[model samples]
Target: MKISILTSLLILLSLAAQTSPVLKIKFDDIESGNIFLINVQKELTDTLSINNGKVTYEAKIAAPTFFYLIVDGYNNTRPLELVLSSQLTEMKFESYKVVGENTVNEAYPNSPIFISDPNNNIAFFEFLSHWKSFYNTIQALSENDSEEQLEKRKNTYHTFLSTNKQIIENNSDQYVSAKMIDFLLNNNLLQFETLQTYYDLLSPKVKESYLGFKIGEKSGKAGQLQPGKPAPEIALVDIQGKKYSLQSLKGKNVILHFWSSSCAPCIKEAPDLLKLQQGNTENLVVINFSLDTDNSKWKKGIERAGIEEMINVCDLQGYNSVTAKSYDVTFIPVYYLIDANGNISLKGTLSQITEKIKEDMP
Candidate 1:
């Protein structure tokens, strides 16, 4: 009986994996298909809201979609409903409020469009188009991957980000588009590349905002760092009472990794990193920064992931670290590999290029 029940459970799990999810949200004035957070009491789960009433998700969305949503962000308050028919799948979004109101109030800057809804349109659709393309590319790379699938994902993501960079003029808004562009270069280019006239296009205020800024101070001007520039430095306290300087490791190769207890990917990558470290102790030094402000969670993550020997470090400032600001890091489980000379050697998805490091370092 026990063996049979275990087998049955496995079968059920497999079936769940194969199923595409359909959701019904009984909220009004929210017809958008933009993904959002689902609140069961106070905690959050993966959910998408209808930006316009009649829309279909058809696939899963990025996790940051949920973060922005939990903070009551992403989609503006618009009415939404589900439309299902026997023969086809489709969506329809309608406008709400007056014409001036039709455009998102300048207050609702993060609001998505109601598709054909007028009055709120900007000339920035090119940026929007590329961002959606990049996000979808990332969404497709979810754990189900064979060798062929992996190649296709990386190539597709690289090309999408590369082509899309042209549409982004400068660091004007430093929102989602800017984040996407940085992710692309850090992951694909390994360093920021300059396009002609990019600096000229940006005003002096945008370029000089970081001179005396605090760690968490954000503006509309975050972009990739220039060549030979020192990586962003930080003063952080570890599990011990000792404080450390991020810039002190000027003459060494440093692997700046960010993680938290809540992330499964962060957990999975820990062992791989330890093994990598043991093998490359001569050139590789890891400075892991945790986003978890909760010390219990931070300690639990370190214990559970078995990274005790790793120079596990954090400022306990969560998102307000000077390094995070300098690099504009928006997500966890990311790392920046700086060369011995203090220039950014590699950036972007760490797992994507682990083998490259293994080959070079070994």
Candidate 2:
């Protein structure tokens, strides 16, 4: 009887150890709504129903992973980003308010107050706060062109970099270190060399994390793209499922525009792009390479922009698309001008591309 009881206790302990992590969220100001949890690594979204301003969610994550939480019908509120590990995590939102009198309502306090953070979320938030302070200071200094202000800005910038480097190094083993590196790189906040140094400081286990691998992959491929280098071959299907390739468009100057439907800047420049294409229809082929994953949105964006004349194509892989990786497309609205010889001639923003076209094509 004693042996049987001991065996049963062992089994129960094993089962408890294998249980998935749970996320508990409490919003004092919100009630009877749905909270969407987006798992960044898995690219999956789960809806958690709020009952009495509280909800509990279970996540099947083995390591520290990034998640975004957004309230339904709250388009104005930025998604709350947090890192979750294989442990119980809790968040609390004390206050919120609906803004604007329009049909669409915006919400405030997108970030949540941590009730219990077993992971490195607290550290990540601290880092974000520091970065934001530094960013605002630099922006304010930019408005003052005095020599003293300029020197102050330079010193402040270097100080920010040094402080961030120290923070990352101190938390090298934490998952938040990798998250900080990713945030800095994605926002173009840090120089490539500094980013590489920070990346190298990550612990072996953190380096093997999902975000870490993605950063390394992007950095490794960054040097492959430049002027005079052969443009990477792009073989992707258009909206109509017709296959297209850069090889097929040889002997013509190609403007490879990387964009996405959700990107406001890309949409804003649509009419200008259409005009450019219309004016130079003889020898120029403008290919709109979209990074949107949703098929309906991609088509709707094209229709709304009235740029059907341009070669609109998408692999529907978003940032994970092979073509985007080859071109080192970190952000959207990136324009690449490839010459008739199939070599990259220039790459820049829309205005710069326009200048290049006017100088070379005219």
Candidate 3:
């Protein structure tokens, strides 16, 4: 009797497991097509063909899972995104131009278009909208703005940062907090004290998650080489076996260019830097720091690119170079323009540096 009862219980449990929730996604006016769902975390792609403009899938998810809904043969363009297991998430796609578009276009029917669980990702979607609006506002600012205008823009950015921080704090337990925290930390927008407090407020589970760990890594590196901050000292040997230091380039406008031989963009921007240095020979100096472990490749690249006009140096440590760490160098081809007083005046792309030089130096 005991064995029979145990077997009956196992059968019931199996049935219960099979009855896990089904996430139904119905697309209206999806003409003769297959929609694919790309799992964000697992890197798995699953497909569902639209039958009478409806497609249903089983979602046995405990944690919030993100899926990119891409229409097949449309350059893998994601028209809709689903953050699952929040609520009864449903999406409706209509009037899509999917044919003959070679490039992956931004998906339309933009957000607050929630699917699955509403509570899980509503904050995240809202944050995205706020960030987008803020970005557009910044982009609209005039490039030839005066010091007062620049200060105003800076103040506006800080205001947005404060607002975003509050949003993250309010939704500390949600996945959106982890993402926002990571972005803020990496962008050098968050204060160290605030970061510590935010981390403390996060639940133990969130603090231990993958996204949380990434946020922790970025938070540890705040206030490294922010604009208007004094450029940090960097001591490294040039390719020609000569030592170079940041202090040595004082009393001249310096470009602290961090790059690598393998970086295509870095190599491509070599000519532009050459032109900038040649054009402003009286006041400018480009200190090119190569983050290359292979000495031979570094030498060859420099010679081939004809970038020997500037001061080039490498410690042969690649990404682990102490100099790179001091400046918080994550991406190569990063340009930090320093004024005669050794304060970082600008930090951005080659074009941005050129624009700044024209505006300020000229």
Candidate 4:
């Protein structure tokens, strides 16, 4: 009778362990610090304490989800992204720097080597690697619009698209495919139809994943703000608590400048934008809608850029702002030109928008 009771207790414990998802992470050189785990899908952050160079996280996950791990006191290191599952996943990392006298410096690998990943996180990292490679190649190319340079850029972009499509096709059954599709969609790399196609090719299990649902939602919202559609209303307050709305600025050609303080490209285009607004004050209104979460930083960015003359507004919700979602803004430095009739005339980069303005307003 005693043996049978003990066996029953052991089986119950095993069943309980199997039902819970666990993640165990070990750092080789780091001893103790607070690590923040950010759930990408839910936008929730949890602080986990590290004891003796290790930390363990346990949660009931519906599906494989993406998370960002930010190490405390590592100001220079970017947040590490990982895909986690509802199964036991173990990971080890060399937290300290390999070269230089400052071993604890900010320079670190983009991602850590996973000791054990039950949920195809390794493949997700490979997808990110490919994206980084393509981005670097494009960034290194000449910026001139010469025929040869333009052709090279076109070929490079097409090649990247093809490579990403192949990767998604090869791993259609994996959760990483959903992540890859999400990345492409967020970056505005794929068209609406192509995004739908890639999403359709995903396995049914992957399509039911958390990221897959998010991709479906994003795709549904895509192309809603096309050139001919009515521009969505944006109501928000500026840094000084001054309220502004797109409806109030009607009957004038409006330039909805979606940006953030952290985006370098946005800051770089501030001067040009300021000039454009100044030159066309009678017919043009440039609304600088900032996606900054911090109030102080938003004020400072505007002051530093010296665009105090233009109308500025922010809701301090960052990407979660309703204005951002209504416009389907996933990337930074996006510009939209709403004509006098309050219709979206064009949406593109600053240069493209500038050319359109010149052609239409002239």
Model 1 lDDT tens row, 221-257: 2344433566666676667766666466666677878
TM-scores, each model vs. reference? 0.43, 0.56, 0.54, 0.56
How does candidate 2 fare on TM-score? 0.56
lDDT of 4 by residue, 22-67 (tens): 6898888888988899999899998999999999997878678888
How does model 1 fare in lDDT?
Answer: 0.51
lDDT of each: 0.51, 0.78, 0.69, 0.77
Candidate 2 on 1-362: residue-level lDDT in tens? Answer: 25698899999888766756479988887888987889988899988899999898875577888888777876334666778887889888787554333522222334568878877587777777777777778778878568798778878878887888888888888888888888877774554445557778989888888888876654442344567789899887766677777788889999999887766568889999999999999989888998889989998889877887678998888878998878876766778899988988777677878898899889
Candidate 2 wrongly placed segments (more than 4 Å)? 1-21, 74-77, 97-111, 144-149, 221-325, 329-362
After superposition, candidate 1 runs with Cα above 4 Å error:
1-223, 226-228
Which residue pairs clash within candidate 2? Answer: none
| Candidate 3 clashes between residue pairs 3 or more apart in a chain or in different chains | 86-117, 87-116, 87-117, 89-115, 89-116
